[model samples]
Target: MTAIDIRDVSLEYGEGSGARLILSDISLTVRSGEFLSVIGPSGCGKTTLLRLIAGLVTPTRGAILCGDRKVDRPSRDRAIVFQDYGRALLPWRKIWSNVALPLEGGNIQGAALRERAIELLKVMRLEAVADHYPDQLSGGMQQRVQIARSLAQEPKIWLMDEPFGALDAITRQQLQDEVARLAAERNMTVVFITHDLEEAIYLGDRVVVLGAHPGRVVEEISVDLPKPRDQLTTREDPRFLAHRHHLFGLLQGH
Candidate 1:
């Protein structure tokens, strides 16, 4: 089953003489329940491609389909977890309410909304901080809350834009493991964008490498590693290192 299908997609910014093409004829398919991570040089249109699938941006050409439906604008089936956790969370609302915000004005309310929010918070190990405001939580804790909120929506597809980029090494690794576990448990189809090669390989079923200066797919590598992966064991595997080297060479234009 295809969760996301991008066919001959291209995105251009500016216009006329000032026009700059960011993505050139990019095409990819994300399978249902698959975790895909996109890696590229700094200026590449990795985020642009992600936004296109998220219905946050329109492609200059080609079509983006999500679960057989064309994506022209944002839909409830998709949720984005951005790198800026503080920006994603509401400073005024308590953690529980923030997690439940997506359910407001629908059917869920009062005790039921609170119950779901608290349940998700517990999944994130944030039950103790349910009443805390965004300002009260640390960076890692804040990001966790954002993740819980995103999960609370129970989105079928998750588009993560370097969600753990802002964290320290330990926190990043910790969350990386947690994310992988949670994604598998929820059977989510994820499209993750990251500059970290190891993180990409560790989290993704397949890693797509994009080259900048007119961004395009340079290489696509299948991890083939067993699931329930851990950072130490997976990273230490010889095959993992080889794939990392291949990506490094691709990024170097070799």
Candidate 2:
């Protein structure tokens, strides 16, 4: 089943005088329970494409369909996790409250909401800092909380824009593994945007490459590496290295 379908979508920033075309005739489909990563040059409209899917921005042309329905506005069915965790979270609200904010006044409340929030926190291994403020936690911890909050929505589709972009190498690797595990376990469809080739290959079932200067799909590579993957196994796999090198060549326009 197609969870997301973007058909000939194009987006422009402004009209006539200051018009800047971002994406041109972009089309893609994400299958249910598939992990797809988009890798592109800086200004390749990768984030713009994600925004279109999330309904945060509408395309000047073409249409987006989520399942059988067309997406006209933001829905709880899709959740976004951005690179900036601080901006995503509320400073005044504690961790649990931040996670529970989306459920406010919408059926779930009191003990049930609290229980769900704590359960999500536990999944991210953040239960110890449940009552802490955003500022009190490290950068990695804040991002984990943001992940928990995004998951709390029980979204079938996750749109992540470099969710671990700011973390140190070790922390980033840890979270990448966690995200892969969680996405697979939940049977969620994910559209992840990142510039890291290895990370893309590690988490994605297929990697889509976009070219800059009027961004378009340059290539789409299938990752045939086996599942239940660890960083060591992925790194050691000959097929993984072959895909990585192929993607690198594509990125370099080789």
Candidate 3:
């Protein structure tokens, strides 16, 4: 089943001569329970495309559909994890409170909400810091908290924008595995945006490469690597290397 459909979409800022065109006539489909990683150069509208799917921004033309519904605004079904974890979290709210914020509006309350928050924190390996504030945690831990909060929503589609960009190498790799595992276990549909080609290939079932200048799809490469991928073995596989070389070439205009 198709989880997302971007049909002949185009986005621009301003109007007439002063208008800046960002995305030009881009179209794509994302399948349910699929891991899709989008990569491109600095100004290739990767984040914008993600925002479009989230219904945080509307296209100048064309429409985006999430499942059978037309996407016009953000919904609980779609959750976004931004690269800047600092801004995403509420400084005054303790870890558990932050995670439970979304559930507060629903039927969940009191002990149940707290329990659910702690549960997601455990999934992110952050249960130990359930009482801590965002200011008390390290960059990586803060990101993990952010992830836990997003997961608490139990979103159908996960939209992540360079979420691991600020973490140390070790932490980045660890979270990459955690995200891949969680997504698979829940059968969640994920739209991951990152500038790192290797990271994209590692996590994605298919990698979508966008071209700059107009920010459109250049190529969509399928990653046939086995699930529950091994960092060492998967990266070393001949097919992995082939896909990497191809993406690098596309980005470099080779």
- Per model, how many backbone clashes are there? 0, 0, 0
What lDDT tens digits, residue by residue, belong to model 3 across residues 30-51?
Answer: 9999999999999999999999
lDDT of 1 by residue, 31-64 (tens): 9999999999899989888889989999999999
Query: TM-score for every candidate vs. truth?
Result: 0.98, 0.97, 0.99
Better of 1 and 3 by lDDT: 3
How much is the lDDT of residue 136 in candidate 3? 97
Q: 1 or 3, which is superior by TM-score? A: 3
Q: Model 2: number of clashes? A: 0
lDDT of 2 by residue, 1-254 (tens): 99999999988998998998899999899999999999999999999899899999999999999999898899999999998998989999999889988878888879898888888899999988888999999999999999999988889999999888889999999999999999999999999999999999999999999999798999998999889788898888999999988989999989
**C-alpha RMSD between model 1 and the true structure:** 0.9
True lDDT of residue 68, candidate 2? 91
TM-score head-to-head 1 vs 2, winner = 1
The runs of at least 3 residues in candidate 2 whose Cα sits more than 4 Å from the true structure, single-residue gaps closed, are: none
Cα lDDT of candidate 3 equals: 0.95
- Candidate lDDT (C-alpha), each: 0.92, 0.92, 0.95
Model 3 has how many clashing residue pairs?
Answer: 0
For TM-score, the strongest prediction is 3
Clashing pairs in 2: none
